[model samples]
Target: MNVEIPYFARHQLSPGGTWISSRQKSLRTFKLADIGEGITECEIIRWAVKEQSAVQSFDPLCEVQSDKASVEITSPYDGVIKQFLVGEGEVAKVGQGLCLIEVAEDDTTHVESTETTGQSPVKTPVQVTHDVAEDTPTEAPPSVNVPLRKHPLDPTNDLSGTATTDHVLATPSVRHFARQHGVDLAAIAPGSGRDGRVEKKDVEAFISKVPVPDEVETASRQQEDVVVDLGRTRHGMWKAMVQSLEIPQFGYSTSLDLTRIHGLLPTLNAHIPAHFLPSASTPSSPRISHMVNPSALYPVPQPPSVPESGRFTKMTYLPFLLKTLAISMMEWPLFRASITPAPAQDTNKPTLTIRPTADLTLALSTPTGLYTPTIPSAQSFSLHALASRVTHLAYLGRQVPCGLTVKDMPRRGGTISVSNVGAIGKGEGASPVLVPGGGVAIVAIGRAKWVWDVSDEFYRPNDDGMEGERRLKIDVSWSVDHRVVEGAELAAFVETWRGWVENPERLIAVAT
Candidate 1:
């Protein structure tokens, strides 16, 4: 019953003399490369290469999203994509094989000796329980109509019945079966199946055991359950937050009298450099004319080094606050110090590394996640220069696509972090967390609210009875690691900060 087959068809066969194609073709697994510093994993945003499609070296294969930004991965060899190990919308660890590429004998530059010697590496097929089929036809090309299986961790994955607080491990078929019978998968207990994956039989058995509910009863049963898997950035935040729980922290709260600083803002804003201002300026803007007349407000000195572009034009309390914070840290050296465990050579005692300059981390909240961009050597920059840098960093953080990169968050981030909680709302105080690697001390700046002062009694005689004037004051809450800093030193440190905050003119002197 042997029938003569065509030469092309014979070459495609898996057995007999047709093994030449198999011998010449080699499968190489391409692993994910390190896209950014400190990034452990990334989510596959999209696949550029299709299964069995020919691709040249350096061609874009896929796009992966890291905490910093979305990056494209390219091919290293001239080959055809065999299969994707980690599907789109799924998280893949750094250094894990992303996909298998089938390379021709002549094209594989440095393929393993085993692969080139007619012996192919054995690969076990990954078990796919999802609705989407993993296998693609070897002969047929990829089709646009083919629907991809929605990843279990995908945020947009639809929920049919009551959304489960926990992830339901049922297969697509089981889920479909449950849906048809109006069965809620979340109510069923985990089955005795492998990895506790709920089988179709498990769903059926559960449905059979439960009594049927009326339409009214089903309608009245509110489904309040929701399930959301944390993205890479958010997950990292969670881990960092959990690590902070191990540190012994203490809090100190005080108010910053912004009476003088507030009055100085109008003058500082007028002196902002033209280079930092927006391109479309207001025709009658007084700020523009005052740029040339910098002598009026004590010329806003240019920074030692300015970024290619500065985003801040108008000065605010933040730039002043940052300036003073940096100055205070410089005066009190301990505030600029971080305690580290003993080096490997000397395991008996711990070590303290005190930075010469004050590196400040500004806690900025973004849509993606919380980022603390470091302003290295904040004391080195003038008030105007520091304001520009802070504005630039904030601009990067607030970009629609998030322009913040790994360089923005230096590895040796400051020994202190500042969270301007007051800028957002009327919060009186906040107990900010001292992130493990972030710093030893963190401060939360609350909104400046007008408060009546009664200190006039001390200055004036008891008989002179004069009502105290209203002063705009802000609350500054401090959280410090108890292991490194003592209460008295922290209080004394706060007193020094208070002195600078109360008299912000000292900041200009210090900066000069």
Candidate 2:
């Protein structure tokens, strides 16, 4: 069945939710909620529904681009999509309405509330209405009722139970989000929103200062484990990274003489220009701030021999590689699919084959675990467009927005991934593990070095025909989904990438 997903709407929904109390009717619009723990707003990039299309409650309704990721906004209530208040690339603040949906009237309704003090009100009893499913395991209410703000000294009170457990069972990213929100792990209660999942809302009401109920910790030997939280971007990456590990892994890499990228640097600099080479310490700048200032703080001068390629293009090589990957993935749709929901009817369990209109949810790691700021489509995105996205996300990683709602990455669609370790000098073989939900591939780019080849190689200039040749040796590792991508095709993919670097113009065709 073809479902119509309109990018925009010509009308708003009539306020009739009050009348649909007894029907399986559609209701008013519901905006995108807090999907990540630290995310404050997101740009609506695509709509999965139009003004009048029936949608399943959990069906992907819209794709949202947060500072952390580009994820589909699932319908919180099942109904017909009645209207759209936001459009593609339009930034919507947290809790802003994005669309309306009419739902089947049921005994259940969303109960919103908040705590009374400098603590979370997470344990406020919520009527659980959802059951665990592969797509949405821990379902929540339509909207969380945020308590009207209160003060510690305010004479307001509720008998809301306090959070008692310090170590809650949640993904590392969720744990971090709880901390970022000032959710005290010691207060409130743990209710697995799905299959007993203590979801984001449960954590929101939890606080570290809540008194321990009945001294449960003193009764058990508590092993010490420092919890690290993976935020939305990291959670997404964790899901994808795991998918890549279960497959047969392979890697093929070759340095693009870099001669052309190096060559193009001079011209590109004359037209645009760059500040410096990017590194771990590079400060991502607008993306990551807090670094020394070039004018006042550093008191440094541009190196006289700084080549434009090294100064500008060199800064963007890996991202271009990602663009190169996006082109390949578009040509090979199998790479972006998840393999869990196989067709039992087929001889070979058919993995889910997807052709994403956008592949911008790629993530990188940080101290907090993993994070990704949405990058635009790789195929037609300009270098500036790509660079700007990378820079912004890199900084957001450091900024760590508070009060953002985050959930554990459910095992699902992971197109592909890259892990770069080449900046220091030499490549090292890495066993990047699979993140526990879903994902099929991860590429680890190792160090770089020059090798000497002694022979009258016809591939070189005549002046160096009989001399020892210096060629850069680069290591590339590919982690694949054994469920779908096989070793041979995986090798071919890497080989094709290798060939592109071997001949830089090959990249231009894709770049243009």
Candidate 3:
């Protein structure tokens, strides 16, 4: 049932009937309002409201801490608070409601005696609804200038008055969030409720609180509106990233031998649990008979299966790929940089301004989802050091809740990406996706399969440490920003990756 609130403000939601209440809607649903100039997301760090607390409109609801700064959102209308949409430490996007309130209806008849005690003219709160004409959505509240002033005090007595900005009349918290977003405190009308305090509720009444009587709001008007499903924070991120297309892109691909990486699986299974296991899994855990008998039956004491992520201690392909990324990046310093659109470059797409550093971005795809966490720019060192870093990042990626099957992590802002399709048993020749955000190049790897030794023991020991000539096709696919790095430079990077993987010992030798 739609819980009828005594009064409701525009854009503010109440217990929205069944579809909402059954889902347990709150009385005052204060969604993320357009806080300050074009800010899309904020981190919800603390709540100013709690269950059953009495509240007035524009009262501070909670602190929405953002990347730039933190601001406490105020309640829009006078009401009693009931619930909140997000938890602490979680992030909320712009326009998403934060809390719920129950507006008390028609309180004009019951003004408290205290409200009448002051000679300061008691202005009645008139509720004006912005009705949508039949088939159109109402525009955001108008930005009218609301007049603010100090109360009339002993006019005849000469008293020393304090001098501060007009915002001094506003609550400290209100001024803080406002200042964090560059909102002019003087522009907001003073609270007529009591003591001229600028409560959170006043902030929500965009037009009513304007200093100038004519309600002419200065906010940009919308021509049309489209909903953002993942919220504007995610949308903003997506938009900001795509803007880098002015930087040119190029790609290169090559075949890679992984037989050596394959050889290490048996040992990995023996020592490591299944959790740490990469995409490929072997049925090595066969049931063995119990040597000791319990009562009348020989109960086999079974342990848990291998950890899904396997173990970090064991040598895996992650280390090898990581080492290659780091070692190769040393020669490509531009890749290691994070500053936007090389300083010397113009807005137009050009090939010359890119850096040479190989700031690596690892793109690992699993049954669960895709993850492309940065390997930090210019992270170059010996192969062993690279191995250490690779293992750490790989383990960290696995722990990311979004990286699992439920949520597919979005990958962006990486110079080079390494996606291991090999884990899913695909051996050789698989093309990975070119993540939209100017992601220049990507490397696809396949499973280490055995190849026949026809050409002078072609399948020699590579990185995974397995001996014996296991014939395997080396599958490596690379995509680049064709403008900056040429076809040959991309080729050279791959050639280096391939060479290191093939002569794993050479990497080890130099690293040592």
Candidate 4:
């Protein structure tokens, strides 16, 4: 797992070098490909072939596990594996060399050189120390530079160059922090940790040294640092978060009265028929009611598979929220559109791509990471149908090795996203992130709480008949791309959405 490419081997064929003879030995370096969209790297689970092993094109080379799923990599050439640059149980970055292939040419006579006509020797110097404290200045160690040049196929000399990690050694948390601050890991001074791995403290130190403007000074902090290795999903999230900075976002917050939905849940939940219940004789039978018929208000092109029972046992306000949002997207085409930048050869002006149906992404959080699975053509699904899709997506995301696949996530993706921020805990609202390539807007659903309305005439609501006329409301936070959407339009959209939430009977009346 701790495989490091020898310095001599790595420099034998520099990027600028070329072969002398027509039958000269050629080395083909196989770099890891972008396995999935947005997947920057994957952990090498195991190697199917060893060094010096013969392999034909399309042969299984190794198996890799991304945070999303496990995938097998294949050989691209009919040659022997020269070396495994990345070993088993190590992370391999996209576009980085994974192994070297030695392609032998069919020639009998050829002359080799010693002084270097084809390749140039490279000498690299490395520095090592236990720690480098700001206050402590230690004497520099003696300099030792070695010139390395050797045939990559030769296995004679095992000269070691330096103790270095095959990949950047910072934890996931540190990587996220660095990306957030726009700090390049390669530009930072060598970390004091083992294998010269960068740590959270190093990033904090780097951030502290950055000079702030005199008018806008930041308070200094000396807090303990923590490092976390980001899983596959978290890494994907990190990349999305970094890309989000490019979007100019404008937010709008409004409170929706959930009093009607709160009162309607008990009735809807208790209306389950006997046929919908799982039979004792058929243990595998679906227990939840998946029978959702399309109506004039909400139509379904095709219903998603029936989800397992328990999640649908009780009705919640989420289904109603999804239903209303889908309807709103159908009316407002801008919210269901994405900006496609123009190509270099074309005009500089970008164009917008509008979707015909409302495809909504449900932002669900699990132990693994955040996943937003799109519910395609959401405008067609009844309340129960939408509820079924939400339950299934959440179940899939929580499964071990995550059952969600690339097919489940559309390339164009959903036009709008909804996050149940209230499920985690009580909060006024959250400024949800609209991932760059994800959707045009994202709305956060805050916890529903009881609030007293003081707008009533003095002592008006306190009448015996009108006693306890309090409002039950939830906060709705909207984040829209300013490049595509206007602030005034977002406010109007929220107001329209609030009308649906306040009138629960409208949803039921439209149900088949």
Cα lDDT computed for each candidate against the true fold: 0.72, 0.51, 0.51, 0.69
Which residue ranges in model 3 land beyond 4 Å of their true spot? 1-106, 109-121, 124-251, 258-313, 334-339, 342-346, 349-358, 366-369, 377-413, 436-438, 453-470, 509-512
lDDT of candidate 4 at residue 500, scale 0 to 100: 81
Candidate 4, superposed: residue stretches over 4 Å from native: 1-227, 273-305, 309-311, 456-459, 464-468, 509-512
- Where is model 3 poorest over a 10-residue stretch in terms of lDDT? 16-25
Ranking by TM-score: 1, 4, 2, 3
Candidate topping lDDT: 1
Candidate 3 on 310-424: residue-level lDDT in tens? 3344565656666666666675655443334434656664333355545566665422234455654434443334444555555545541222211122233556667777777
Per-prediction TM-score = 0.59, 0.45, 0.43, 0.56
**Once superposed on the true structure, which residue ranges of model 1 sit more than 4 Å away at CA?**
1-224, 282-309, 345-348, 456-466
Error of 4 at 396 (Å): 1.2
| Span of 10 residues, lowest total lDDT, candidate 2 | 2-11
Per TM-score, the best of the predicted structures is 1
lDDT of 1 by residue, 1-512 (tens): 12222111112222222222222455778888655445788888789989989988668899886655766677777778989999987889998989988764421122222334554423213221112122312352343676544323323446454346235665434655687687777777466566556777888788789898897877776455546667545877899999999999999998888889989989878876656566565235467766677667697677344564564657878777888888889888888897787889989888778989999999998765788889988887777787788777877877634667556776679999999888789989899999888878999999888887767522443455655766888889999999889999999988888888888776555534
Instruction: Report the C-alpha lDDT of model 4 over 362-478, residue by residue, as the tens digit.
Output: 887875688777888887887766666677677778765566754566566798888999988999979998888778899999998998755542236454655445778899999
Report lDDT (Cα) of residue 108, candidate 1: 12
In Å, residue 275's CA in model 4 sits off its true spot by 7.2
The clash numbers for all candidates, in the given order, read 1, 47, 71, 2
